[model samples]
Target: MNKIFALSAGTLLLCQMGMAQQKMVADKIAAIVGDKIVLRSDIEGEMVNLQRSTVDNTLPPNAPCMIMEQIIAQKVMVMQAERDSLPVSEQDVDGQIENRIRYFEDLYGSREKMKEVTGYSIYQLRERFRQPIKEGLLAKAMQDKITSSVKVTPSEVKKYFDAIPKDSLQFYESELEIGQIVIQPKATKEMDQYSIDRLLEFKKQVQEKTSDFGRLAILYSEDPGAKENKGVYILNRNDKQWDPDFLAASFRLKENEISSPIKSQFGYHLIQCIKRQGDNITVQHILLKPNVTRNDLAEATKKLDSIRLVILNGKMTFGEAVVKYSDLPMAKFDGGMLQNRMNGSSLITIDQLDQPSERDIVLLLDTLKPGGISKPMPYIDDQPGGRNGVRIIYLKTRTHPHRENMTDDYARIQQRTLQLKQAEARDKWLREKIPTYYIHVEDEFKQCSHIAQWIGSIAKQ
Candidate 1:
């Protein structure tokens, strides 16, 4: 079976995932599984979407047949999910849709550009995605129910590793696990007042129709995403990711009303409410951070230097220092380790450190050995408001270049072993469950060997 067809880790998100939906004409049924129909146009749409989204316009052979098989599996799982009365909340589905819209808008540079390319308004796109997103959520729920109990043991992991042909073993680069304790200096009261007064002036200009809010944000907002999005955000009331103060300040403003400068964790913001629908609000804002002087940077470095002394003397562990003194709140929970955004692994490579600040820290680890801590170093912080900060680097572990093996790559092997076991379990379930469903395949697609077992029992028309 193609990896796409196997429900190993989880059900794949819908085929059009974040792709703009294109209208289809002259559609015909491609296949039917348990009353759920897969359209020929659906497969074509997926091909077009993949072409647009992928860097290389390349696809596997027999792509249509593979897509047909994948869709059949999804339809069967969705049917089972409904039969089992699995609950998928409308709120969750809506959130995913909204996020997808924002992603595509960012991809195309703006909502207007996205609308021009996709021939759909934001409202129309939401309606178009509703059913597909709901179905995907149901399929994922059923997949989790089926494979939730699957597990792998140490022996199974070794067995999986041994079965891989020695010549085909993957080679890994030198990777490092790094930790840090950062300190950010506070700006003086004079600087804070300066930022607040600047925002108040911008608000007055917008209120007096002397300048545009978005233009001001584009030219002045310190938020990094403001460069691409013009400081615009579609916010949800229940979303905990937004700062409480910022959320409250934005929500209090009526449409077209600009708020007085308000302080949030990031900095001071001047918010202008564009539209609101129930708990969702569309707003634009300008974020400004108070300037830090040379003296302040030196003070922050001195503070981190002291924390480094405590850590080196064994009075406190690096993690303890991070929890007690690091300026970044979330770093404490992660033990100050920089994690790979793709896999959440503490072990990461120079390339995996996408941010320039993170890469700079790793580059400085040449003289430090494993379990060694470096002296206080100043680096620019990469956050919404870029700020100068000081940090001490701790190199936890380092791995040399080597071929895949049981000792060096146990975690990676164990994960792969678990996925294989889950795939087997999923296939076994499908072998039994497929017979119970009313399945039909077009003659052209019946030639796909991968799906032979699925449609073999159905008599030819």
Candidate 2:
């Protein structure tokens, strides 16, 4: 049996549970699957989120019924996962909850602001989000277990592609594969010391009660997020999103204790731990990044320009230069080749290259032919090490727009074919599994045609 369940339990559950706590309306059970209960508030809450998410801010007439079915299906998968003793680690759940909190924090600009908007504190939100994320992970694990052995053949891929109507074939946009060797502008030792000393002074002011941490952050923190977030953040130790140095300093501090000064990729920071619960902690901090002087920028440009000359003169390969001279540690292993985030390939779409942050790269690509390299250009580094730097861009490949074909797009077609076969297997599994579970749907949603299969299982009740 193959199944293709795309129900996102976290999104559905978060909207439902978070809103359910705030609303005073009486809630009723919409359906029951085995020991699991689906509430009317769950459906209504998902509808609310959907309405809020849309461009026109509208929901379909069948939105409630559609959401209800998805929730029911998700609940079924979760219950089955539990029965099978499928394991989802608490650490993984905590990491996911932290990621979700960080997402909302980024949206609202701070944990405090997020609380103000959502009417729930970070701790309360975590408690609400934990179960849903856990359930979603469990459902995915069960799905993987079910589909672990599924595989497709070359012939199967061709058969699936040939069966598609020609008019329905997908048209791809032009994509560019560009690479680079980056050289980050460095601050002099004196400049680094100056920033650290400034943070130490801010720390002293806060400790002496001469200034509030938030006030100092507002005045002095150079972190762009801190400008809006008031330098406050909730972090989980296991979450990799935080800079390692920042995370280490944050966890090392006792509640109400301020760190002297810490250096991270972002720059210098003075941290104060506000609260801690198990693996999660909240902190307020002031950041200060050393100014990259014109001299420093020129130095980096000169270094990269020299490296570019060496590559141009056939003195060293770009990849060898990346290993020996490039400051970007991550690009070294990949031979300085840029990857398409969608498919993890060296090929990327032109439309995908239309990011405002990549505007410089796009402009440079306009003048570059395949295997051509550009002169040193100034750009902002948005990787783990956030700094302004110079880089020589490499135009590896440019793919033109074309219809989906077996030769150029075999991997894409094969993936689509495998998904169809998996969906068929899942459908077969559902037909067999649905009867084994005790399922019920209220008469209000009897009109939803897609849930007819689940509705048929009502006879077992």
Candidate 3:
């Protein structure tokens, strides 16, 4: 299993304290690979994090030993990455830390609650995570380098499958290939003007000092993150994720100055530059999306209804219909097929449809058979600016629960085979690299059977 080096702020703080408090005895090194060392507290900290985060609040037997091995491997990889001069940028590391902070803040309800729970301010959390996050990035870079060229041929996949005992073969639940054609109703030009005017008014209020930008954002911003973040975001000018128009507008503003309402894909926004430091800019904005009236939605429904007829009448393929009519951004690439978010596979299970909007459509799947398309139904699109939209679902294929077989489950088996091959390649690389490093294991962990190879390497040294 691939283990990510992610510990919550609270756990990380405790671990840091443990290392500091143990200074009287001198923080013991659990193991060393090349110039990288794994501190004893690092293992304990990860154990605590895993125990708390696990679904059952329990850990597997020998979990510590497993964690020790994983951490040592990471250290080795990080050392190799440095030798190879893999480029892990400060911007990338900071971006990961910022994302983690936002995630925990969302989890704990707000920034205040997150600070209360974690006992660390965002800045402190960033400082604590910086090294570990950077090390993780380096390790990942090395792992990717090791496995980059590994591939499995069809014969190898078949051979791997044949080796699995018949009775031990995997069982699979029913899966589905679901497709959709989403149509977001366009607001009339008058409604668009109305939204733009509202944002302009908000900008005027802030400029006149009648109200602050954050207060107006809290009250009126349609952005989901506005409730907690008050429409504030730290943006990197070079990050491609931000809407180009929005980013350009933000970069144009002077610190403490608010912009006239600017339109982006999401809607109209009045952005205030809170701070600027080189490429990183902190900004607050109030977003106002144009309202979609019942008539607008009905028109979209009618249009989808017409498109559905064209598909049902065999006049157009579902893929063609999606290409010509679907408004979803991903439709251009995926032809409206919903993919498993975890794996990007078209095959999805009912349980995988966890979002409310997806569940609504999943309920309709009970009546849909292979190649069946449902009537256009109204759903609130879950995207940032997607308030209300209409969609028609296409059930391309449905699988019955069964034992895995080469014929029915080739794709899944192929994926597993490829993963196994990659793991083998990584192990081979580790075997070749370990002997070249100066290895060490403290007396406490010397008896861990999993580390015997490292201990032997140390003996050879």
Better of 1 and 3 by TM-score: 1
lDDT against true structure, model 2: 0.79
For residues 318-391, could you state the per-residue lDDT of candidate 1 as single tens digits? 88889999887679689999887767789898787778688777578788999888888887776545778888
For model 3, give the 10-residue run with minimal summed lDDT: 1-10
Weakest ten-residue segment in model 2 by summed lDDT:
1-10
- Candidate 1: give the clashing pairs: none
Model 3 — TM-score against the truth?
A: 0.74
Q: What are the runs in model 1 whose C-alpha is more than 4 Å off?
A: 1-14, 17-24, 48-58, 82-134, 183-194, 201-257, 271-286, 292-303, 306-335, 341-344, 379-388, 447-450, 455-461
RMSD in Å for all candidates: 5.0, 5.3, 5.5
- Candidate 3 residue spans exceeding 4 A from truth: 1-28, 52-57, 85-112, 121-134, 153-167, 185-189, 202-219, 223-258, 271-285, 293-336, 339-345, 383-386, 458-461
Q: For residues 88-159, what per-residue lDDT tens digits would candidate 2 score against the true structure?
A: 999888778876777677667766677777887666777777778888888777777777788999999999
User: Which residues of candidate 2, in runs, are more than 4 Å off?
Assistant: 1-4, 13-24, 48-66, 83-87, 98-117, 179-191, 201-219, 225-258, 271-284, 290-356, 371-376, 382-386, 445-461
Candidate number achieving the greatest lDDT relative to the actual structure: 3
